[model samples]
Target chain A: MDKRKDAGSWNRHKIQAVWALLTNSYLIGFAQGRIYKGSLKNLCLPGLSCYSCPGAVGSCPIGAMQAVIGSWNFKFPFYVAGFLLFAGALMGRFVCGYLCPFGLFQDLLHKIPFPKKIKTFPADALLRKLKYVILAVFVVLLPMVVVDILGQGAPYFCKLICPAGTLEGGLPLVLLNESMRSAIGWLYVWKNALLLLTIVASVLIYRPFCKYICPLGAVYSAFNSVAVFRYQLDQEACIGCGACAASCEMQVDLIKHINSPECIRCGACKRACPVGAIHFRQAGKSRQSNTTGL
Target chain B: MKRQLQSSKAGILLALAGLLMAGVGMHRGEMSTVFEKAVKICMECIGIG
Candidate 1:
């Protein structure tokens, strides 16, 4: 392993590590088994953390969108929509690589030595599109179409499908609060089952949730090709070594699809490049940064 | 530089649009609405009911 490549991975991992703590640092809320009621709850984190999580000071954007869209008024989730566009424009799926607690969860699970590490398969590309379906149906259409007597909609994604809510928020709350435990029913049981599936799948595959299920990642991926900061391939300096593609778990064809929506901007290719060909170009910066090879 | 400008154009427009929409949401008191809902006053928001 090249020390330079190792350092880059380390820096990213370090940010992921600190981010996990900072995002869920409302310690007293966890001890008491109560959700944080602070004003910070109004802001949406780029990650898919559960607002119901006792320690979550900020709301998850997906949940926030559903909440607003599902409200009786059925207004557009302007705030949440804005935030997603804002985040997408700035970083694309870089958030998936470095910021999301759920992404961190899956990354850790994938590291737990398994019989096989499945990067992708025949149905991988098709399966990857599932997140967009989930975003369209569970997050958007279902909430709007399926309404109650009062015209309010349910947070369908959170209640029915979100392992983030189940794992981060539901599990901890149920464990600590006796009252919540007593009230646990079929919905809780169903969510826990989904959470269990996600955990098991993570061990066998890499970032399975990000690849297939996370609606937030789906949103960010839309902007990946044109995000303000993105990877660039210098055709002039290229040797076509294929190392970058070989190293990429996402299997992105580095030259043809340098900034494809599927690319998570994980820098795995950048690390794998033996030649000084790949670099990150910021929107307004005169020079591309970190153009040197490992 | 021309290529760079072309690429950055979409992103800059998107950022500005996001800011404008967020401003509208703020003016409409939607942030407070998010707060109220995140507080989880009703069980149905989380599907317990």
Candidate 2:
């Protein structure tokens, strides 16, 4: 553990921890079976904090959307969809960059003392499209098409795929309640296996789930180019050097696709740029912000 | 820059329309239903269902 870097050194990580803590403030019920039946539960947080977590005081937008779609009435999820669209249009994958609790979880795990860090592989570009596929199939189409005799469809992604649901909600609840352990079945076993694999993979790879799996990230990425909060490459100052791309873990070519959908707006490229060529810019503003130092 | 400017305006307008729809949904009591579900343990979400 001595070989590990000091977590306190990274200001971004500290900010991320603060955000995660602020969003999950119902710590009094952290180990409890009863969920907080508060008015705050009606609102959706901008990140992937599982609704089933005892400390969770708000609905996960994705889970909320799935629930709405899976209801017996099969009503349209206007609020959830609109919330996602509005958030995407406003901040793009900045939500993932700055707010997502699951993103922070993977980030901290990757910081653990590994002998060698893995670089972005060639297949990553192709595999990143999988999240969009998941969004289309599991999140949207499956719920819309497949319904039980009672006209209620299952929340397929949450039930089958989401490792966050397994880790944050399942593991904690099952561990705390003796009664829940007996009820666990093969599906629980399968989810645990998936969660374990994802945990191990996070240590080896940078944001493996966010890069290839999270449907929310896929949805937000669609708005990357048009989102109000954005980054600009001052072509005039840029010398076409590859320094920015060299430091970017997301495999984004900073000089080429300055606002690439794959980019989380993590500001790594901006920090790496030698000539201060990259900076933050809002959509309507004529002048860029002094966020290059960030 | 012109194209980006136009897209920005479009994005803002779309967000406003989304906000309106979300408001309508809230008025229709979707918020209460969402809260009702959120307060539950959601066994299916944890793969126990």
Candidate 3:
């Protein structure tokens, strides 16, 4: 099995998960049950790390985008949008594959030694498009149009969705302070329900929220084709055996959809390629460009 | 193949332009609001507000 081979060699995904934890470790705040209030908070992380997490030192980009869009000052989210584009161009969904804590959670859950492993169903492909719709409707349009008397729009996704917020921020804070428990309302209950659903689904499906509902992943997916860090396919070396395509958990056909929006750049295909025909290289390199089909 | 190459070039240009726009916005103190928002506990983010 590829898993045995992966263990014999270097495991890139494990190393990446370690890196993600170290980068976001503002550990003192979690110990004290208080979120960090520091200058670093002004900057958005490349991944969907929650801002309200007690241990989080950096801001979540999607949260910052919604906050900007929903503000009373009602200006375009130039900074957030620009940051997203820059990050997308730099690495595409590499952040989702390696840097995101929520994505890591899903990955770990899917590894839980269940008797039966869940495979992608027929509807899974169609459902993957739902994240894009959520990006358009909740993250972009709703935040701009749904306004209050003060001309401030609600952060609709954070309030109504975002299981990360519920798990990282709400649960911890409530458990830490019993007084806060008395203030729990319908929104809290709804959020908890969403969190419960996401937790259950992650065990049975690979990155359920990322595949069907993450607005940030949707934004980054668009840049997969042209991101500076990208996958290179050596067409000459490939035998059209379809091994790389079959290895993809996201169901991407690596030959035809080498840099498809669905790819998270997790390097699974690179490991799975028997002939070493697939690997990551600089996008603008002349040799790499000559080899790429797309 | 030519069309794909052209699109890739366009994507690079678009990214560069986006980074420039982000720089301009940051210089204009747009980041101040992000700082303000970050300092406080976002009640809505926790699903209570």
TM-scores of chain A in all candidate models:
0.95, 0.93, 0.92
The order of the candidates by TM-score, greatest first, is 1, 2, 3
The digit string of per-residue lDDT tens for model 3 on A1-294 reads 466445522354575577667656878767777888889988988888778888788888888888888887746888888898988887889888877888888877777667766668889889999998888888878988988888777778888899998887888877776777888899999999998998888888778999999999999999998887778788899989998788776778999978899998777776677787876755345332211111
In terms of lDDT, the poorest run of 10 residues in model 3 chain B is B1-10
TM-score of every candidate: 0.94, 0.93, 0.91
| The 10-residue segment with the lowest total lDDT in model 3 chain A | A285-294
Of the native A-B interface contacts, what share survives in model 2?
Answer: 0.61
DockQ score for model 3:
0.63
Which pairs clash in model 1? none
Q: Which pairs clash in model 2?
A: none
Candidate 3: the clashing residue pairs are none
Flag the better candidate by DockQ, 2 or 3. Answer: 2
**Top candidate when judged by TM-score against the true structure:** 1
- Candidate 2 TM-score, true structure as reference: 0.93
lDDT by residue (A16-98, candidate 2, tens digit) is 78888887778866656555778898898888888888778788988888888877753788888888888888888988888
lDDT of 3: 0.79
Candidate 3 Cα outliers beyond 4 Å, as residue runs:
A1-5, A8-10, A286-294, B1-11
Residue A80 Cα positional deviation in candidate 3, in Å, after optimal superposition: 0.6
The candidates, ranked best first by DockQ, are 2, 3, 1
